[model samples]
Target: MKLPVLVLCLVATAAAAPLALAQTPIDPLDARDVRRLDKMEQVVRELRAIVFQGRDIGKPVVVQPAETDYQLQEVSRRLADLEQTITRMTGDLENANRQAELAKRDAEALRTENRSLSDRIASLESRALAETVAPPGGLGGASSGLSANDLFSEARQALTSGDYAAAESGFREYVDAYGDSSKAAEARYWLGKALTARGAHADAAGSYIAAIRGWPSTSWAPDAVVELSRSLIALKKPADACQTLAEFAKRYPKASTTVKTRAAQARNQAKCAA
Candidate 1:
């Protein structure tokens, strides 16, 4: 009977232990509160990422008013300098263009005048050929004749070759040796040309006068008359130049452009004197 009672007491103790475990209490708010704490921790971590990105990784730049104003002032100053330099360059270019135009006009006028003079010389040369006379001497001073033509040709050769002393001597010999020959007129005229080349304007004027008077019927007379006036002008004798030019015009009304050019030059001297 005591053994049966001990077995029954063990069974009863085992069953009571299972029932107490099943009846233990559970907290309903504990799971919800834990979930809420986890959500709060996630939100804090997201906020830290946004703050770090904005402050440490890629922050917006703030401009200072003073720096902005200084940059604007520098740009304005540079623009002003550029404008002034452009204006000065424009003025210089305009001046250069004006000068170029003036030079072009002068060159054109000279060309026209040269063409006219060339035509006139061609006509005069044709007329002179018809009335030309042979010099007493040939090209050389071989014989006793020794005319002005030989000496003049030699002088021209010398002058062309830049031998001034020989040219002067030859021209002087021409005037002395053949004063009465028709070729003497040409010699005397060329002597004046040679003298002028040697910078002896006073002597040149005298020789030109002698040439004109020596051969009034020859073609060289009109040219000599004009040349004498030009020589006088070169000598700064404007009064004499005017008188000689007046005589030339009276003597040769239908003179060539070369003669007219000398007359015009004489008038220029007279005007300068005035």
Candidate 2:
């Protein structure tokens, strides 16, 4: 009876797999889950040989043999183990899906900002061109009246194109020239990314910390939280990394899906418990 009950549970879970797929992210069954299912299949085969073939289909299979009861207990234990693992895995999948959605939204936001910055840059250049016609050095000066958003977007483009040094310089200049600009927080965050890309984790952590402290309310601040943790990890400061991640949820109560996911992962990397 216990053997049939266990097999039925396994079959029920298999039937519900499609619903899980719809609710969770892409991977419904990880390697451990696959291995556990394989083990369940083998257990079912053993039960079929031991008790299923000789039993009446609708009757309660009360096994009299002590050895058969032991087998039943073992199968039941395995089933319970598999069930618990599946529960945890489902939670992880859902979290991953949320992160993916957040990343998609973030990308769209970046595209929109880029377009807006480009329009402003065009307008600024037009005015600069008119001014340059009257004086040869009018628009050529470093003080040529470009907005912070325009300069930040250009530096971001260079970063996207893998020009780390150019990106770093541009970001630094923006931070220095427009420290009070709405985009300065993001610029500091990207400066950290640029520095980290060049194997300067120590310097990168400083920029990331600045991003967090200077623009804690900005959208990029949450991302800076995760990046700061990662930079600490690179500096062989696992405890500090874990500490930074520990405060993530509290600091950024409304962090994006991806930022939350990355925070969890960074905590794991730091070997944080609970």
Q: Best candidate per lDDT, number?
A: 2
Candidate 2: tens digits of C-alpha lDDT, residues 178-208: 8788777788789889988998887787777
Whole-model alpha-carbon lDDT for candidate 2:
0.73
Q: Candidate 1 — which pairs collide?
A: none
lDDT (Cα atoms) of all candidates against the true structure: 0.66, 0.73
Instruction: Report the lDDT of model 2 for residue 20.
Output: 87
Q: Candidate 1: where is the Cα deviation over 4 Å?
A: 1-149, 160-162, 272-274
Q: Candidate 1 versus the native: TM-score?
A: 0.43
Q: Could you tell me every candidate's TM-score relative to the true structure?
A: 0.43, 0.46
Query: Which stretches of candidate 2 lie above 4 Å from their native place?
Result: 1-145
